[model samples]
Target: MRSAVQIADARANKPGHQIYAGRARAIIERASIALRSSTWVPIATGFIEPVLYLLAFGYGMGTLIGDISTSAGSIDYTVFIAPGLLATSAMNGAIYDSTWNVFFKLNESKLYQGMLATPLGPLDVALGEIIWALFRGLSYSIAFMLITAPLGLVPSWSALLAIPAAVLIAFGFASFGMAITSYFKTYQQMGLIQIVLLPMFLFSGSLYPISVYPDWLEFTIKLLPTWHGIELIRDIWFGVIDFSSFSHLIYFLVMIVLGLFFTTRRLRDLFMR
Candidate 1:
């Protein structure tokens, strides 16, 4: 038999103990079931959209724009934009998975309601949904990298690091997106996501160098998560690993923590109430 002190410790730990293991597994299992019922068309479509952007801007417009200067030195317009597109794709995939899909599950299908009725709690649901978003984002990132590699866009083997970097980006955005989604009670609020994401996509140093912007605007863009992601991916693609690279990693890690904190707190309030 366990000692009284040991039993008390076990009981105390039991409240949230399963969150890191069992609850997460349950959430993932739920996602897998939903994915099995879904079609591949949407996945194929997501992969295609980024490729279209690369073709349109990287090649079609590259002819007119010529070479661009980057921290990695002057490079073809296509080469410079390619990694940024990969970052964009990862961001888009994660946002879509976490926001709209999660909204529908939270509100329409009442999915989280059902999960909360089980042994699972808000934290489990939050993590599971974010992991699923990361899964979708990673898939898109891998496909984008494969396409770019043969085209000579990924110049170094260090580009393989892009996969985990993409996951970190996705985790940050997905958690952030989920946290935002939790506060929204109506579909009309979702348009706000577009308003925010579109500008970040355009101005986050993804399509153009931040040097084109004034100092204030450039500093603001650097604060955006996607800009850090773009810079991180660009560095990995060019084989430039340094202290700044680790700083980008830290930025995303911090975002992920903040996102999870807000998401879990919001979910508990929304559901527990």
Candidate 2:
């Protein structure tokens, strides 16, 4: 009798849960359109910058630095920087998706306004856009890793885990960028994210180890999510797994949750206006 009653309750609760799905599906469907394009140009563009870094720094500067020390031990400078590049790639790709692409749709293109005219609400648009951005970041990560393969950079199985690690980092920052976007009214403000994030990308050990910086700077940079993500990927790629790896993973996850929380609230407020 209890099992029968529980089944009845579950069935009764299902409809209420399914109520908003139509709006969600519409938003996802709209975002997927640009993704399906033959747009080889964008893909080519993403690869060039990372490839330049790998060639210029990985080969050119590897001579000066040689093998660098880590918790595991010293590995090739190329190896150390490989994961940082991966993390930066993920970070930059996600920020672009969330900021420029989002702003264009929201303001210049008026696409979001059109979507708002439909059943889709701001929350639906924001959620779908973030999900779509995650998809883009994932695509870029796999391609970048494959490009890095012949360089003999991927060290082991844990190295493969960097791809998903990249995904999580991208999602967290992308959502955070989206949240920041809700607060801004113009492109002038958007440039600050680029200016700030680019410097963080360069200084966060994407090209060199963090200890190369002075003690104070090291302490400060370590607090940034990019630092944690870069360190985590560097550890995995170089086989330096430890408790700190778990800590880094937790940090990015927390960032993701926090970003989502603020972004949802901001979107709710924005569309209500």
Candidate 3:
């Protein structure tokens, strides 16, 4: 009953559709091996930095700042900052894995070069690295949330939504980070990443509300991927669901698409050529 055009289209797409199947699995297996070799100490240690910030700023600085006002209503200063920390945790974890770990594998280790010798292609490597980064970032976000829960920072059941939101934030950052790192030929270039990331972390309404910024600056901050990420987690933590929350989701989704496009293109250029 199918038309000739439909049959032709299906036949044309078949080979391309199979490209991701076994190849992506092979790349993920490579990631699993790397994960098994990694030490738990460093992973555990990463949790400490964010917790320290939460305690120092939440409790120490909270004494002076007291409660803060948000769209969700008035909240303890510590609680107000918790979701922002979660966003930062996701960003930090993803960027570290995608940039440093990926650069090491690509350049010094020549891991991806070996990967290309197999049935896998550039897209598989790109996707596998991204998945691994998301896994690491999500782990950090979950640990931070667990630490926050006992402190009475998470008031709403909606805090559960934060897991997926954190994953999305991590995905956007990891993909974007990998795409950017593909252009770097030296370790010294990694320092430049901090120049971009630090400002986004500090000024993206993470420590304070965007309303306090100048009109132009506030508009610029809102356009940042991290700012949208922070707002998404904050809104979920406070149980504030609305159109803006969906808009934040859309922003990260766009980042993921553009990032993947660039990453796959760059990887092919680097490894396949």
Candidate 2 global TM-score: 0.87
Candidate 3 shows a clash count of 0
The candidate, 1 or 3, that scores higher on TM-score is 1
Worst 10 residues of 2 by lDDT: 13-22
Regions of candidate 2 where Cα sits further than 4 Å from its true position: 1-25, 37-40
Assess the local accuracy of residue 126 in candidate 3 as a C-alpha lDDT between 0 and 100.
84
Each candidate structure's TM-score, on Cα atoms with residue i matched to residue i, is 0.92, 0.87, 0.91
Question: What would you estimate as the lDDT of candidate 3?
Answer: 0.84
Task: Provide the overall lDDT of each model, using Cα atoms, as 2-decimal numbers.
Answer: 0.86, 0.76, 0.84
Candidate 1 structure lDDT: 0.86
Which RMSD values do the candidates have, in order?
Answer: 3.5, 5.3, 5.0
What is the C-alpha lDDT profile of model 2 across 1-273, one tens digit per residue? 567446445545544322223355666677677768746676566656776888889899888878987776778888778888888778767776788888887678878777665544566677777777776677777887998877788887668988888898888888888888867888899888878887888888788778878899999998998899889888778777789898999998888777777776766566556
Candidate 2 residue 187 Cα shift, in angstroms, is 1.5
- What is candidate 3's CA lDDT for residue 204? 91
